[model samples]
Target: MSELDDPVGSSLHGPHAALARRVGRTATYPADVATFCAVPADPAPQDWADLARLVGPGGLADLFTAPGTPPPDWTPEFAMPGRQLVAPVPTGDVDPRVVELGRDDDPAMLQLATATRPGPFFARTARLGTFLGVRDGGELLAMAGQRLHPGGWVEISAVCTAERARGQGLAAVLVAAQVARTAADGGRAFLHVVDTNAGARALYARLGFTQRRPVLFRGFRVPG
Candidate 1:
C-alpha cells in the first residue's frame, strides 16, 4: 500500500519513529502528544489485541483513517467523513506577521486549538513538527502546523483562526506558511478537512490543494 494509505503506521515507522510507543505490531503516539494509533491496514486479531494492550482497558483507540473495525465490544466515540488534499508548494513570501512558535508557546497553542476546535491538538502536539502563529500584540490570533510525516509528505493540521479574527485571511496565510516550511524540508504538503466544511474546502482549493481521497477520522473506546 502507498505510505499515504496508512499514514499513522508509516509515520510511526518512519519520520516520527522516536515519538512512537509500540506494543508488538501496533504503535501509537503519546497521549499528551496525540491520540492516534496505528494498526496493520488489514488488521489481524493479534493486531487488534496489540492495540488493546497498548492503549489499556477503557482507553481511546483513535484509529485516524485506518479502515479496520475493532471488536464488537469497542464503543464508538466518533466518526467523521473527511477528505485528504495535496498541493504543490506555493511560491510566495510568508506573511510578516507570522512567527514560529516554540515550547514557550504551548499553553497559548493548546488554548487556541481547544477554543477553535480545529482538530485533535494536545499539549505536546507541537512536538510533531514546526508550528507557526500570528499574534496581535500578546494575543494569539491564528495558527497552523504540521502533524503526520508519511514518507515524502507532511500533513498540515490545526489550521485555525480565533473567532474574532476570522475573514482576515489568517488561515490562508498560516497554511501557506506551513506548506512553505514543508517544502524547505523536501516534503510536499497535504491536509484533511471534514467533508461538510464547504468553506475550508473552498479555501484549500484556492490555495491549490486538490482532493486526493476521502478519509474517515474515527475513534473508539477500548472495552473494559
Candidate 2:
C-alpha cells in the first residue's frame, strides 16, 4: 500500500502525540467532553487496538500525527494544521529571575495560560515536564517549559506572558531559557504553533527558531 497506509511508529511527524503516549497522564472520558480525555501518539496498529479496547465505547481521545495520517481504523473528529519550529542552542544564559514552578504554582499557571490562550494547561500539567516562569512583584508574568521529549528533542510549549506584561519580551526570555536548558541537557528544543498565529510565528522567528515543517493536530472521539 502507501507510506500512509499504516501510520504506526509515525510520531516523528507530531511531537505532542508522541509525548502524550509516552509520558502524558492518560485517562478515558466517561462523560464525553465533560470529563477527562487522553491521546495516543504514533500508535502502532496494536497500540490502536489496545487503546480502543481500553477506552471502549463511551470514551473519547485526541492525538496528532502527520497530516492525513491517522492509524488504521481510527476516526478523526477534526484536524488542525500547524507549524513546527525548532531552535538551536541558545546563545545566552537564562535570566536569574526565572524560577522553576512546582505543583503549588499550578493555580497561577493555569490562570495565566487560560488568559493568554497559549495552549492546554490542565490541573496536573506540572507533571509533564520542567516549567519555568517569571514573577514580577509577586505576580506571574510569563512562563514556558518542556513538553514532548522523544529521543533527542524536547518540545517547548506553554510560552505565554500576561497581558499586563506584554511588550516587555518576557515570553522571549522564557522560550530562550527553555531552549538553553534543553541544550544544557544535550538535547534540542522545538515547538508547535498554529499556522495562523502570525504574531507568535514572528516572535519565534526572532528568537532564532525556523519553521521545520507543517503539522496537523487530529482530535478524535471514540464512539461513546
Candidate 3:
C-alpha cells in the first residue's frame, strides 16, 4: 500500500462521526452509528473502499481532509483547498443585515442557493444548524450558514450573494456574523473554500481569520 493509503484522515471521524450518524438524514448505504453514509472525512482504506462501493462507479461522494496529499484512487471532480479560520467575536453589534434563517425560509434559501450554486443545499439542509441571510426588500439576496460540527468546530458554509447583490459587501457581513455566532458559542468558526477563489481567501484573511491548516474538498465518481 502507498503511504497515501494509510489510515490518516481522523479529524472528522471518531466522536464527530456521531453527528453524521445522528443527523446525516440523507445518509443511504449505512446509517448505523458505526457507518454513517453522508460524507466521509479521512476514511481508512477499507472504509474508503466501502464508501466508494456504496457510491458506485460513476456516482459521486464528497470527502473532506486536512491538507497534505490524497490517494490516487479517490479522485474528485472538484478539489478545494480549505482553511479552518477562527475569529474573535465582534467587539460591537453584529451586522443588522444578517437575518436569522430558519425552516420557513427554505423556499427563498433554496431559490438563491440554486442560482448561486454554493455547494449542496438539500431540502432539509436547514436542519444543520443556525443559518442567516440578507434580503433585498423581500427577495433573498445573500446568505451564509453552518454545515459540519466536528467536535467544537462549526463550519460556516453556503456563503453566496446574488449576482445583482455583489459589491454591496453582503457576503462579508454575512460571513462575519456567522463567525461571530460561532465564536459566541465557545467554539471556533471554520470554512472550506476552493483554492482558486483567491478573492474569497483574501476576504477571510482581512477578517482576521488566519489559516490553521489545509483541508481538501474532494468529489469522486460513483459508477452507475
- What's the lDDT for all of these models? 0.91, 0.67, 0.63
The 10-residue segment of model 1 with minimum total lDDT is 61-70
- Per-residue error for 135 in candidate 3, Å, reads 1.4
TM-score of each: 0.97, 0.76, 0.74
Error of 3 at 217 (Å): 1.9
Cα misplacement distance, residue 126 of candidate 1 (Å): 0.9
lDDT ranking, high to low: 1, 2, 3
Please report how far candidate 1 places residue 63 from its true position, in Å: 1.0
Higher-scoring candidate on TM-score, 1 or 3: 1
Task: Select the stronger candidate by TM-score from 2 and 3.
Answer: 2
Worst 10 residues of 3 by lDDT: 2-11
True-vs-predicted CA distance for residue 195, candidate 2, Å: 0.4
Instruction: List, residue by residue over 87-154, the lDDT tens digit for candidate 1.
Output: 76579898899899999899999999999998889889999999999999999999999899999999
Q: For candidate 3, what is the TM-score?
A: 0.74
Clashing pairs in 2: 58-224
lDDT of 1 at 215: 93
Best by lDDT: 1
Candidate 2 stretches greater than 4 Å from native: 1-47, 56-58, 66-75
TM-score of 2: 0.76
Candidate 1 residue 90 C-alpha distance from true site, Å = 1.1
Residue-level error in angstroms, candidate 3, position 205: 1.4
